[model samples]
Target: MPISSVEKDLDALTMTIVAEFPVPVRRLWDAYADPRQIEKFWGPPGWPATFARHDMAPGGRSSYYMTGPGGERAGAYWEFLAVEPERSFEVLDGFAGPDGTPDPAMPTTRMTCTFEETGAGARVTTTTSFDSLDDLQKLLEMGMQEGMTAAMGQMDAVVADLASFAAGRAAELQILSDAQVRVSRVIRGPLRSVWDAHHDPALLRRWMLGPDGWTMPVCEVATKVGDSYRFEWEQEGGGGRFGFTGELLESLPPHRAVTTERMVGVEGPGTVNELTLTPVEGGTLLTVVITYPDPQTRDQVLATGMVDGQEMSYARLEAEVLTPA
Candidate 1:
């Protein structure tokens, strides 16, 4: 109820984010109401929660199947608080089940997300509180800051694209001048299996975007640093115009892959992306890292439609690699 006063009233107050998702509190509240909405955006990026549950109340607990690339499941939970619908909900992690039962295996923290109705849209302020400085530091050290910031940017795009149970007219939205939106997926799959989906021309054609009616004629990958690859996609059949290309930055067999991508329409080769694959109990864990070499470019893309592409791409990758065939 007393927001700004949270600093004076609470012990060890922490500040993290303020995001405009282009949706009002009423509709944004709906996402919290329905379990399906939670299912859609629960994972970091490119990963889907295989098994998800939400009680949606003050005393409830939520769970999700953290399906990494190649189908490895890591479980996560959240304990809810202050359950006011469409207005606010606060949650903390590292708590035992409904009862006092304890589990020391997992690291935990607390989170508070408040929704406000603004003329601009629903401004969501999320605060991540830690039991100890160590917990907060660990999250930052593990790259949570950059990733969450990008995820919020991705959320704003989703809110913009949604058909108006909540919608902010494109014109009303202040254009992003410079902002970068990014997402990462930790994938665990067999090196050969992951490689096949990436290297096989036919398989690659199934996922990558196009201008429609595109065909892959030349898909070459070197799989090692300094190795160049060319991907040519065309619609006119013989001698067409569409094409995309990238050069290998570094490739670690069954371990990791990095590339610099260049497309036909874009300014130049942009994005130095890395995919690290780690072997898990029954599958391979693949982590995708996308970087914008220039800060200005990153900020510009974040302000523009870059996030839409990132979110859609992550969803597509989840479909292609994480799901069971």
Candidate 2:
């Protein structure tokens, strides 16, 4: 919704769109880098764009098609002329066929997108230069201005959704008593994948661990009622080693799982951890409620930065396992 104005320069044979987004320059740039994120808002309302392929780099090619209200499709391709990460990029845009072949009969434009950091957020400017004044007018008459405005507006929602998963942003850490702490993350993956990731040790080792350099060298899972499991991890240099063994109290595959967790090398009461995954648009919402035996026990865990550690683990899971397959 930070779109301010669309300007057309007849003498210069160009069109420019100016907008602001309350997110970091890197985050905004990622919207352009990820095709899945781009497809969410690459076209105007009711004309959703489907990207067949996207390679974001100099000399790279991206192919996509937009479906109109009446089911008609318009395909386009971008020949990336230059790329500069979170700074600026230039691309040659033109009409194309379903097979991603460029159409020589159609007009083309060279467009450059730039991003700048402001005190409040990031400012984005996009300028497209046509071959001639006549071509510029032709695109304007085709509602290019209004269509792009609407498409850019959808980016606000896209960035917001990304921010929701910004490591602990989706979770609320609450201390119910001297004995309970809860951590939740809204994962953007299907319920089944998330469920498997939690219940399958082989897949869990990929994302469920401490910060970089730490490894879950031991993971055993038996996700069944009355079954048991164990997890062991240590820092890269063999320092700060810790692990936990637990018994499964409840198991509802792809939905809910409960276990009694007892930690080693720590003097405190074991905790009851319940993990729940609920289906939601674009992914699943995961909530883990940990109940300690006493307020002293809860405070002890909090002092260990458990919340931040779990948040980091979930963030990794989101990037590696939660992405839509």
Candidate 3:
């Protein structure tokens, strides 16, 4: 989607960005001024963020929300630079520790944004300057500046079709494979009810594969220390079913369950699965953690992904726990 005649411009001896958005300068200004709007679009594709403030005036500060791989939040702050209403602004962006204290080793950048009204719409020309050419060269080497540029591009498009962009990510990849499925759901039911449902083979059949077809080789253990089991799984497709042997190494009954599984197939070495159930205000929060030995296995597993096999197991757990009598 690169357009010719990109309206490229530069400032003397410094790196710069020049582009036009669909909206006017003032509208773009508001998007910068409003924290909520900033969160909608900003940063590179696949990278998520949040805006804590948009102090549009001088001496105002802003915070950014950053999430790591497992959805854990990492945040930081930036101090505002020159600010002129709806026209231009600048800022010194840095990496602050979780406590919001600036870490001096990570130098801040000076960013300048100028808005001009073009017939196409308002054009935004953002130029970022470092203290030295060496610094600028370093950032380019680190892929920092280009990342921000792509992020701005993503934001501009997001401003127009938010819902469509979201749907595109959530839509099924539409792949057909004889891969395994793991489904999971959290149920806010009583502990006793969930426990009873789990113990009953009839109720288990409703959510899990009935004992007739699948091997329930694992079961019958105290929900206490050193408890465990094994399972033989056959997928819907015929690529050769796999067997998994593991145990319930630890348990805080009705709270969390720790299980380690070893795969018996050419596909994997083995992986550990951890399930946590924390009682919430009304419902219990269920989490499934799968630690893959290598990135290759992770990628392979995702290629066959639908409802992940572990997630499916959690779904079965939820059904047994929450189904009403």
Candidate 4:
């Protein structure tokens, strides 16, 4: 077990757990920063987790759920209060309903996690403060301590598996639910560069083209919330023309963005795409969570080989836009 100690303070209504790992601090931090990696160890054995959204910046929120042995699910959410990148982060943690809404009846806790380097490797100290003594007692009775211990026990393996989550890999797709899917990739560029490539029309036109033998003729980009953008692509020698139009819903420079995307001439509801970028060990981790209108719509979009197209585009981005001459 990696856990060094677990201490509970009844007078202060707080509990602190300390764990050490034989890895560099950055490696340990990246495991938590990347949703794909963190989800592997967030839940105890026999209860795997799936994170639909994981924005690590302040004012952001992460929603996830754990599936039990018998197919039961327990949902939870975290509201990021502060993030000091690779050093520490604080969050308001609480239970949530299946829909990812916080359960007001359940007690919430403020948890602060600090990372530091040790002689051998690194250490993470997590301190969770309850609102009251009753709240602390209530959580302990619910196996909170045991669950945490079990969850951290799996982190050692995740942190050691560097090749799987390294940069230069193809984009990966994860189905969060019937209506939601998450696609992730690590770009060989900085966070700001990746974010800028998505916004700047010139930069986008250069790399956003999915496959060879195509040209992007129209590249209108949304600069702020509520602004609409359009993009159209045509095959070489004027074969077929297609495009997507969307309105920016939320924008947090260098970190996150949310938009509504649809086919230019389509009539039905569109998907809400949430994009998040985080600096990790290898490069910038880019995650896009798309919420479709329903399961059929989700399946239809994936059937078009969307992930493969995305991978090609990303590869182009690295070669044409991000790589230094």
Better of 1 and 2 by lDDT: 2
Alpha carbon deviation, residue 150, candidate 3 (Å) = 1.8
Model 2 lDDT-worst window of ten: 163-172
| Overall local distance difference test of candidate 4 | 0.94
Ranking by lDDT: 4, 2, 1, 3
**How much lDDT does candidate 2 score?**
0.78
Task: List, residue by residue over 177-218, the lDDT tens digit for candidate 3.
Answer: 122112223455654555545545444445545322443433
What is the full ranking by TM-score, best candidate first?
4, 2, 3, 1
Look at candidate 2 and give me any clashing residue pairs.
Answer: 178-295
299 Cα displacement, candidate 1 (Å): 48
1-325 per-residue lDDT for model 1 (tens digits) = 1112123113563645776655567656655443334445555676654323345556665654555678665556777766675677888755344233435654577787888988766777778777666666665677666645544544543444344222111111112112222232333446477666776666666655433455566778666688877777667455566565678886655545678876657785487765554332234333344566566777675566654543444345446764678
For model 3, what is the alpha-carbon lDDT of residue 262?
70
Deviation in Å, model 1, residue 312 alpha carbon = 34
Better of 2 and 4 by TM-score: 4
lDDT of 3 at 235: 39
The window of 10 residues in a row where model 3 has the poorest summed lDDT is 167-176
Q: How displaced is residue 265 in candidate 3, in Å? A: 64
Displacement of the residue 140 alpha carbon in candidate 3, Å? 1.7
